[model samples]
Target chain A: MLLEINDIHVHYGKIAALKGISLEVDEGEIVTLIGANGAGKTTTLKTISGLRPLSAGRITFDGKDISRLAGHKRVLAGIGQSPEGRGIFPGMSVADNLHMGAYARKGDLSKELAEVYELFPRLAERKGQAGGTMSGGEQQMLAIGRALMAKPKVLLLDEPSMGLAPMLVQQIFSIIEKINERGTTVLLVEQNAQQALQIAHRAYVIETGRIVKSAAAVDLLDDPEVRAAYLGGDLGEPESIAADEPAATADGPAKD
Target chain B: MKTNESTRERTNGSPTVTNGRPSFAALTPRARDLAGRLPAALRAPGLPLAFPFAVLGLVADLFRDWWGRQTGYVRWAIYGLLIVGALLLPSEQVGGFMSPYSDWAQLLFFPIGGYILLAIGLNVVVGQAGLLDLGYVAFFAIGGYTMAVFGTKFGWSFWEILVLGVLLSALSGVILGAPTLRLRGDYLAIVTLGFGEIIRIAARNTDYIGGPNGISGIPHPPTLSEWTVPESEPFTTLGLAGIAPLKYGALDGRPYYYLMLAAIVVTIIFVKRLESSRVGRAWASIREDEDAAELMGVPTFKFKLAAFAIGAAIGGAAGVIYGSQATSIIPRNYEFIISATILAAVVLGGSGNLPGVMLGAFLVAWIPERIRGLQEYRILVFGGVLVLLMIFRPEGLLPSRRRKAELAEGTGGMGSLGAEVGGPTTHAAAEVGK
Candidate 1:
């Protein structure tokens, strides 16, 4: 395992946001956690990113405990995140926003710039524009581009498809897949279970901060209970088919 | 070919599309790149060059004085040449046209110049870093009082007291920032305001610090042996190597003028360099949005404290200069009004704009002195003018383009509703949303 979270608990004042959540991500795998609104999906990501301190248990990445490390130091140690709301530096230029992700690095950012531009060509054309002026989808692209500039070993993406049009949503997922294929492991948190599971190698289903199920992407798509409660389906309906496969599989045709 | 054609089209009149929206490319690519790179490059290297250039300029002036002493006719000719230069130059540059070592100019420029330095230092915290620091004047007062006590009561030299004052002010800044920085906006402002008042009250009440009467007879800075002129009998214009004997007095305006001028130059360079580094960017980020900055891995609390300490240290340096040059310091001299005045200077000049701040300081400090007849009405007129300026030119006299854009965008919907009313309305709405 590249990262291990052993029963961590997190609290926000009197409210417990995460209660004994445990999961693992093996090296070079796309792992995702899918849940509904207020299911503590964001809380889980925040805990891993060190934005919120854990109350109990330990988080170890690459054989070392990082429960005590600050968020920036964790970023420097190769865990980079594009936060849920697309936290681009709104006041800064698109190019300057990208530069900020590489703030921990020393000298020569041309290579990083090139890599980011290759991934998102629209970003190159709008490099001089302020990040605030971008459309929601474009801003999402900028946020992802910024996180990639940090040269992380593992990228943490939170709701990359949120507030995006269906076409842009498809594009973002494909880019996430491309990013994973380029050798960086990914941990994604999403409410869009259908799209997230399509690209993920393995996924965990969480409810109210507790992980209720964990399985391979195909298996989770086939699970009736998961499809019924969390995947927005009735009990007797065929399980939502994984969209990647051809028509007429054992699971039936994919839903539009 | 298409890329080059598009580049040329952009250079022409084709509206540049930014983030799938229209934004006119006001500055060309080369100009934009230069603007980005120049400040970052010059910021670090500029300070080390300042002291050397100042020393060299002083040496050159001394040589010019010696050359003028060669003959009575030569002295008269130099004066005539300076007069003609003043007549030909613009009114603004006429200050430069005068003799570099003029006593009258020194007296007029010194205190206000010191205030300008203090404003820039304060700007680093309140303006660039977006920390509301009404107790900024406390740092200035601490510096002044430190210099007065050390230089006058203890008989310490000016240079030693300067270092002591800076250290003391920095300590005070850290103390103030540690407790109040956790508070945001108005709460922070109120805390700092109370802190400033407390410092002033303490200065007035403390008998060890001369109580309400304050300290006096602070000694002039000790001259370096190499630069010091010998205290000899008056000689004719025709002396050794045809150089006239230099005049010396307790308040010889020439030496103080050069010293203050050097101090201003040093402060400018220091502020410019500081605002360009990684530290500067961090401060800017904090200023724009604190919560966002915090999430981006900035240790916001620590950086805010650093801003306060650094600003206080600079203010302390200015205070030392003010006390030594004036030869007295009093609690009455360091009041809330003084803090307001310094803030007014920063705002009028354009916060985060270095040269603009300096110009603002000069205007605010000297204009009233220039028209002493209106001294009684100074506060009324100054306040009225500031209000008018804020109304007409909200971004200041020389506002940075980025700051202007921010203000424009931040207040895009509330056009001409008056900032005083609109500012609170929008801020309340934002808070409610949060």
Candidate 2:
């Protein structure tokens, strides 16, 4: 396995955000975690990234225990997260943001920069523009491109298609599929189940912080349970979230 | 909770009620007549534009912008000219044009220079790293005490003491930052405030470091002894004829001022470079969003501590200069008010910006002296000006584009996003942005 998250439990004060969730992503595979709001998909990714400490269980990357490591160390260990809502440094220009992504590493960024620009040509054109000024789709591209700059063996993508238009959603998924094809393992937390499953090799259905079902992506796509619950019966007309509903992301609840 | 909510509502609603009621309706005939008798110029359109300070500030800004935009040799030439101008500003003629302020202007340089360094140091902490270090004076205290104790008790040279003081101050900064950095925002502020008080009280009570009387006899920087000017006619003719016999004594304040100027120049260059480096980016990322920064592989804590340490070191350097120049020190000198004033300079000048903070330091240091005649109203007017600045330009007088954008408009793209979702994890994230 490129990454293994074993029965990890996470807490938000008295509330259990994730309850013994276990999942794995093998080399070059795309694994999707599908769930509704407050369902712990984001928490699972965060726990894997070491942003959230696990109450129980452990995560190992390439046979090394990584559960105790700090967030940036995990990035160095080849776990990069394009956090939900595209966490681009708004004050920094596009090139600087990309440079920051490569901050932990050293040596020539030209190769990586060129590769990222090739992946998203739009970004190359706006290299000098600040991150905050970009459109939702472009910012998402920057987020993904930034994560790729880490050259991670396993990429953790949390809601990459969240606020983008339907057309942009398709384009982003295609890029994710392309990224997976490029030999980097991917652990994807997404609300758009149909698209995520289409690109993923394996799918895990989580509900209220526990895995309800796990199977091949094709099997889960055809699975009636996931369709009724998260996919909302129709996979044709793209669904839109409650604007800020996804705000329930795994960042944990606001501390009072 | 219900009562508190109602109280909040009442406070918010009073402004609305007043807004709906016309001021003229509440004004009695006598009050209205008095208002009508006020000067006609006050009621004229574009009144703010015509205001003296506003006009002066506009002109100053224009000149500053022109100077700031010069490139390469031109920029260096301008800076060289300014340095020469500042160096040659004789104490004899200082502020003579403004008769009332003349007597105090010469005394202003030392404090103004000290405050500039402090403001720069604090800027790294509060502006770059976005950590509100209310206890910054602790570092200054550490620097001052080190200079005093080392110079007197140990019989160390001033230069040697300065190095030791700066290192010790940096260590103190790391000590303060390491454990309490997890505390964010107001919680962090309170802890630092307590830390400042603790340092003051500890210094007062500790006999080893010298009790309340504090260490004194801090020596001035060593002078060039037994120097003789060579018979170089060409060297003397370069407008340095008066400066031929070199002397580094601190008695005149000129040598000390030049040292302060050198320190400022080196610090400004070092800070500006650091601001654009990888660590600088990390500081900004941490400032923008700590959680997101961490997730993106930026070691937020390490970078924050680095900024704190650098800031502390700079503050300590300022103290060394201050202590050496004054030739005396007391523990009470490093009080809470000092930290607050330095922070005010950083804020008013513009946080995260070097030039702005320098300007702020100058204003904070120079303005008090200029208004010394109005001592009774100085603090009140000073506080009023700060409040007005906060209300009108919270980003500051000369805001960094990044800071201005963040304060004037809401955060872009991410908006209500805490990044992971639902913004709950955003609790500390919100604090990072500030």
Candidate 3:
């Protein structure tokens, strides 16, 4: 495994956000974590990126224990995140925003800038425009492009499809596939399970801060339980799915 | 909205003609064209009185492009000319403009020059790094006390004490900032405000520094030479006519002014260099959004602390000079109001822009002195003027382009102020808040 999360737990104040969640992403694989809202999908990514402190777990990136590393150090250590809500520097120009992604790297960044611009030609055209002025689709492109600027070994994307239109959603997923094909491993967090599973090599289903199921994307796509709960199967009856829901044992063994 | 108009003006490739509008009748055709390009708030009724300052911003913006492209030698030459002009302020003809002040040069050297230095220093923390520091005067006090203690008790030279003052203040900055900088926005401001008070109260209670009596008889810098300018015909005609000798003395404020000018220039050069480097970019990122900046690979806390240290160092240097000029230091000399005034200067003049901050400082210092005839009403008038200016131009007098955009979009540190004024916030601001 290129990246490993061994029973990592996280808390926000007194409430646990992640409860002993374990997952792995092999090099060059597109790994997706799919779940409903408030299911700890974002928290898992946050813990891996070192934004939230890991209460009881080890996050190993490139076979090195990185649980104690700072968030910025994690970026330098080759874990780049696009972050939830598409955090583009609004005051900066499209080009300047891209430059911020390569902030830790020394020397020329023209090559990286060119590659990002090539991936999103729309961004190249609007390079001088402010990031805040761009439409939702373009800003999403900029955010992803910005994360790519770090040239990370593994890119962590938190809900890349979140406010995008269906057309743009399809376009963004293709870009993610293209990114993964270009040899950078990707850990994608998404609410759109159908699309996320289509692009992902392996998928994990998380609910209430715990990973309830893990399987290959192809297998989970056909899994009836996941299909009903997330893949929009039997859309009118969420109650039928609740009966099959596991008991609330989310409060894991209290070990610091 | 303003961006679209500027873009249209560039695309049109000709001066826009306002068809004999009554509101723009007072302006010349060219002036009207420029006024039309200003933001709507600036063009509001009753804002005409402030139009000249706005025009000054437009003119500066024109030069900013050329200034950004110039070689260091050319820039230095321009700065040298400006410094020479500043130096001539002590001359009778130049100083006579501010007739209200009995000793214009003395006032310029002490409060005006001092405030400018303080504002520039504060800008690094508040403006560039987006850290609201309400206790910046603590650094100033640290610098002032360093000079007083070292110069009076140890009998140290002014140069040695000045260096020590900067180091000590920077060290204090790191000590204060290391833990507190993690607090965001208003929380940080409140902590800093308390820190400022703690410093003043600590100084007041310390018997070694004379308690409430404060330190007195702080030594002046050593005189270089007693070379007096000749009262020749050519010198008199050029308004270089002055009986002041080139030396540090009680009577002559020119030497002190010169020293202050030198310090400000050196600071400007260092700050400008830092503003263009990776360090500046890091600061901008952290200021815009700390969490995102960290995720983007910027060591946000480290850079924020760097901002504090550098800003405090400058404040300390200014304090040393200010103390030396006053020839004394007291706890009362450093007040919460002093911090507020400097912050006002930075915000009023255009927070992120250097020239704007200097102008803001100059006005903040000079206006009260200029209107001394108003007596008790002087402060009231000053407060009213600031209110009026902020009402019309919330982004500041000559805000940097990025700052202008940030304000309009209601993003970044000053977003609330912008949002309250209802500047056209984009969908991005609303989306990001989610």
Candidate 4:
């Protein structure tokens, strides 16, 4: 495994958020953790990024124990997070915001900036505009592009489509897939389960900070139990689906 | 029926209005209109001050243009001209009030230099780093005391003692900042304020630095005028108009004024460079949102401490200058109000932008001297002006566009973790930004 979490526990104060939760993300795989709000999806990503320390766990990224590393050090070690609500530096120009994302980067970023501009031409069009002035879609694009500027080995995307329109959601997910295709592994935390499972190579179902199920994305999509709880179904799972599918298979609504 | 009766009952229980009238809120806009007229009238008397300021503005603009292009030679030429002009201006005892030279220099210029330096230093800590440090005078006191102790106790030369003062103040800044700076901003401010008060109280009670009596006869910096040009005939033959030779033993304020002027200019250059570097960017990010900045890989605490240390050193350098000029240092010389005045300078000038802060320092330092006719009412008027300024333009006279936008976006550093969905958010890791 490229990124391994072994029985990591986390606490806020007196209350435990993650109770010995373990998961894995191998190289070149788009692994997703899907759950309802507060199900520890964000916490898990926070743990991986070293934003929250592990109470009782070992996180080995690239086979090196990194649970004790600092948050920014984690970024330098190649974990980038496009946080929930799109944490864009509102005070900075779009170009400056992108430059901030590459804080951990040590070399020339003209090529990287060009790549990001090519990826999201909207950012390039108004590189001088402040991040706060951008539309939600554009800000989301900036957030993702910023994370990409770090040239991360593994990108952790937290709720990348939280408030986006359906069309933008599709566009964002496709860009995420493209990002994965560019040789970076992705650990995606999402509320849109069906769509996330559709693009993910593997999926984990978390409930109230505990993992309930783990399986191949297609298998999870095809599993009746997962279908009933997360895939919006209560009956038959008729069709085997392609892994790269953007839309969930119309296996039709379950008949009670 | 019951609800209506109860409403009538409440009104019946009350006294009748002799004259029912509109509330204050209703009259607010009209009150505002009346208040608005007061400013133009109040500003009318200050119009005489405007002519000089307008000339100052024009000169500042030309210099700023040269500064932007980094035309050092032209800028230095202007500075050299200024130094010559400052040197030539006779003290009040020599020329009196009508000489177009304010004798105010002997009384006000020295302290003004100290205040400006303090403002410039505090700008690095509070404005650029977005750290609200109310006890910044603590650093200033440490700088002053460093000079006082070293100068009096060791009989050190002013030049060598200045280096120690700056180093000691920087050391104190790190000592104070490293541990407490990680606290949330308001708490940090309170701690710094407490620390400032502590330093004053400590200085007041401590016999080592001379308790409340303070240290006197701190040595002046060795003069170069006679040393370099010598009061000899060759110097007289050089015959630079309005240029007076520096004298060390005589306690002339003009030479020291030039020295302090040089100090401020050098500080401006240093701060401007730091404001453009990666560390500056890191400070910007941390000020905006610590968590987001950390995720982006800007080490917040290390940089905040760096700001404190640098600011401390600058303040210390100024303190040493003050000590040498006043030829004394006392606990009472450092006060909470001094800290507030310096902060006001940063706020009025433009926090985060150097030119604005410099302008702020000038305004803050000049306000008292210009309004000395008002005597006891002077500070009250100054307070009112600041209030009016903040009401109209809180971002200071020349606001930094970057900081203005940042403020508009909310003074960041808000962390949201835990909602059952997100968890309770111990924040044990990143909030401290260790």
Candidate 5:
């Protein structure tokens, strides 16, 4: 296993956000955690990134425990996250935002920068433009490209397709597929179960702070339960999560 | 490769394409055609008019690099000229015209130079790091008290006390920030405000450092031996010719003014260096989005603390200089008004830009003195001017390019003096996600 989360537990005061969640990603595989609103999907990613402290259990990357490591040190240990909400620096130029991604590394980043621009040519065209001014699809590309700039062994993507249009969604998923093809293992947390399952090798279904189901992506895609609960049934339209959960998806129900 | 083709295909209708290249849509049709005809290198991304300016900037950058490389002698010569110009500002020929009321030299040394120093330090916290510090004068107070106590009670040299004051202020900064930095935006400001008041109250209540009366008769910086310069014709001429008196005395504030100038120079050098290094980049990231910066591998908390400590150290340094010059200090001397005044300087001058803050400090210090006879109406006029400045030029007198863009977009809500507003973070995703 290249990355392993062993029975990690996270709590937001009295509420348990991630209760004994365990998963693993082998080298060069796209492993996804798929769930509905308020289903601990974002929480698992946050724990791994060290943004939220885990109450119990450990995260090991390449046979080394990184549970105690700081978030930035976790990046140094080759865990890069393109966070939810496309966290591009608003005041910074597109080029500067990409540069910030590789801040921890020393020396020249010309090659890395060129590769990112190549992966997302839209970013190259908008190099002088501030990150905040870009369109949604472009901002998503910038976020993903920025994560790649870190040159991580594993990339953690949180809702890369969340706010994009259907056409842009396809483009982002295809890019993610290409990224994994280039030998970076991916741990994806996504609400779009249908698309996430299509690209992932394996998938884990999370609900209310626990891993409810885990299986090969192809098998889970065919699973009737997942199809009904998360995939929005045979209609094939992505469910209106707001109608389903009523604000529970906004940072989960962790805040009092 | 196929993925790239599909992405290009989907986004094709968006970016205006001219001659199979992305063309600037915002440009006029004629300008757009002209831009297309220009060399590819000159045609910048979205900004067509920036092509010539970009070329000019590149040439200037190249020239600067060459100048820096060809000779340290030329660099020193330029700096020497600037230093001489600055040194001459307090002289009769310069100071007389600059201000007609009180001594311009004395004003420069204290309120002008001092406000600049404080503003620069606060800019590190409020501007770069996006941490609003309302009670920055607490650090200033700590510095002043450190100097006064050491100078009076322990009889320490000004040099020794200066170092101690800076260190203690830095320590206090860490003490305040370690617990409070977890609080963001206005919450942090409130905590810092409380900390500032706490320091003042503590000082006022304590008798050892001279409570309300404060400390007086603080010793001046020691002079070198009388024979360091001969008491002869040429030496006397040099002394009369505005060579700063080595012997710091009671009446002539010139020597003290020179000392403050030296301190400001040192502060500027250090600040300029830190503003471009890794530390500065980290601060920018934190200011933009704390959570994102942390996730991107910046130790956000540590960097914020560092900003506070460094800012406090500079504030402390300014305080020590102020203490020595005044020869006495009291709790009243270090008040919330001082903090607010320095903040006004930073905001008026342009927060993130170093030269902007200095200019702001100068204006803030000099404006009242310029209208010296109308002292009673100073507050009203000052308020009116600041209000006017805000309405006419919200990004400040010399905003950094980043700040200008942010204000232009009106995304950060920083253009207004809304007390609780945080720096701009991308709300597009949130809005769409919702």
Candidate 6:
């Protein structure tokens, strides 16, 4: 396993955001965690990133415990997260924001910047523009590109498809697949479970503060129980499955 | 529970589960690292920056004064022109002509010079770093009192006491910053205000520094003993053509003016260089967005402490100058009003701009003293003008380009070309357009 979260618990004051839940991500895999709002998807990501402290249990990355590491140190240790809300430094230029991403690294950043530009051509065109001014899909692309600039071993993407049109969503998913193919591991959190699972190697369905189901992407896609409960209905019929697949890729449908 | 429910309802249309599985498998590990490249020497261009110019200007001014004494021609010419102008003008206008030349030396020397130094220090904390210190006066008081207590009680030389004063003020700054930095924004302001009041009250109540009566009998700075000429004759009385007596006291205002001028120049250079360096950029980034700065790998606490310490040290230097010039120091002298006056200069001058702060300091200090005929009414007028200025031109007379851009972007108004380059559209796109 590249990363192991051993039954970690986190809290906001008296309220527990993450209960004792454990999971693992091996190298060279796309793992998706799907849940409804406030099911602690963002909290789980935040804890792994060290933005939030774990109240109990441990988080180990690459055989080293990092439960007490600061957020920036975790970044240096190769744990990068594009936070929920695409927390781009709005005051900075698009190029400057990307520069900030590579802040922990020491070397010529132009090569990295050029690589990010190659990944997102729109970002390249708007390099001099402020990060705050870009379109939603473009900003999302920039955010991912920025995280990529850090050259992390694994990328933590929190709702990358959020607020993006279905076309942009497909584009983002393809980019994620391309990124994964390029030798970086990926841990994805999403509301668009059907699509997320479509690309993910393995997946976990979370409810409240615990994992309800864990399976391979294709198995989960076909699972009647998962469809009925969280995937928006039965995927048993070929016609319904085809319809669901198109809906997942259609423009603006998956935005909500 | 009710608030949480309401917040949940407002956010996603339902009260969803607050806790869920802790999934490390789902944790993405793409690190948003700050690419530590070469220092920003390339990013921020221009040689020597603002500080060197200020130093050069000080040096040139000092050289001009020294040159004026050697030939006596410039001094005589200045007096001749003044007299000529006075004679040429009507009696009422003669006063106006003389006014510019009248007290020009003092105007250039004391309050303006002192206030500029104070404002620059305050600017470091409140403007460049966004710490919003209201009790910055406490540092000033500490600096002044350090000089007063040591200089008067121990009969320490003025220059030595000045050094001590700076060190003590810096120490005081660190002590204050260490505890108060945990508080943010308005809370920090209130805490600092209380701290300033505490310092003032303590000074007033303390007996070692003479309490309410304060310290007196402070001596002037010592003369350079190496340069020997004749005895019991004024230095000014000596002609440049022949070697004459060296009377140290006669050199008085000229030397003091030049010394203070040199101090201001040094401070300006230090601050300007600091602003453009790695440290300066870090401070600016923190000022703009602290959490972002911290996430970007800046040690926020250390930088903030440094800002406070540097500011306090400058204030201490000013205190030394103030003490030596007055030959006395009192608790009343370092009062709340002095703090307010310094703040007013900083605000009115355009917070981070050195020249603007100097101009502000000059206006605040000199205007009141100049209008001493108005006495108590001067303060009322000052307050009224401040209010009017705030209402009419809140950016002060000369705001920094970044500040102007910020204001323009914030208010959704057109500013200069640079401001218009990145306006409210960017902000809107970031927050709501998504």
Which numbered prediction scores highest in DockQ against the true structure? 3
lDDT of 6 at B217: 69
Taking all chains together, the TM-score of candidate 6 against the true structure is: 0.69
lDDT of 5 at B367: 88
Sort by DockQ, best first: what order?
A: 3, 5, 4, 2, 1, 6
Model 5: lDDT equals 0.79
Residue A254 in candidate 6 has what lDDT?
Answer: 21
Supply every candidate's count of residue pairs whose N, Cα or C atoms clash at under 3 angstroms: 0, 10, 0, 6, 1, 20
Who is ahead in TM-score, 1 or 6?
1
* Model 5 CA deviation exceeding 4 Å by range: A234-256, B1-81, B93-98, B224-244, B406-434
Maximum-TM-score candidate: 3
Compose the digit string of candidate 5's lDDT tens values, residues B1-434: 32332244234421233443444442354234334544566555524553443343234334444554767788879878978767656666566666778887678788888888899999888888878899999999999898889998999999999999999999999999999998777678889989999999999999888888899988888874333334566545434363445667777777777788888889889988898999998988887777779878899999999999999999999999888888999899888998899988888888887877888888899888887778799878988778756643456676665765555334343422334343322232122233
Model 4: residues with Cα > 4 Å off, grouped in runs:
A218-256, B1-103, B227-245, B249-251, B412-434
lDDT of 1 at B53: 29
lDDT of 3 by residue, A171-219 (tens): 9999999999999999999989999999999999998778999999999
- The two-chain DockQ for each candidate, comma-separated, is 0.15, 0.24, 0.36, 0.25, 0.36, 0.13
lDDT of 5 at B331: 95
**TM-score per candidate:** 0.72, 0.82, 0.88, 0.79, 0.81, 0.69
* Per-residue C-alpha lDDT of model 2 across residues A1-256, encoded as one tens digit per residue: 8788889898876678778888888999999999766677777887888878888898989999998999889989998889876777776778978988888888998998998999999999988766755678998999999999989998889999898899999999998988888888889999898899999989998877798889999998777556656566554434433322343343244323
Candidate-wise lDDT, in order: 0.70, 0.74, 0.82, 0.74, 0.79, 0.68
Judging by DockQ, tell me the better candidate of 2 and 3.
3
Interface RMSD for each predicted structure = 8.4, 9.2, 7.5, 11.6, 7.1, 10.5
DockQ comparison, 3 vs 4, better candidate: 3
How well does candidate 2 score on lDDT at residue A248?
Answer: 39
lDDT per residue for candidate 1 within B396-431, as digits (tens), equals: 555553454344335211111122222322332222
Instruction: Compare the candidates by lDDT and give the number of the best one.
Output: 3
Provide the lDDT at A177 for model 3.
95
Q: Which of candidates 2 and 4 is the stronger one according to TM-score?
A: 2
> Between candidates 5 and 6, which one is better according to lDDT?
5
Per-residue lDDT value at B283 in model 3: 87
Lowest summed lDDT window (length 10), candidate 5 chain A: A242-251
Better of 3 and 6 by lDDT: 3
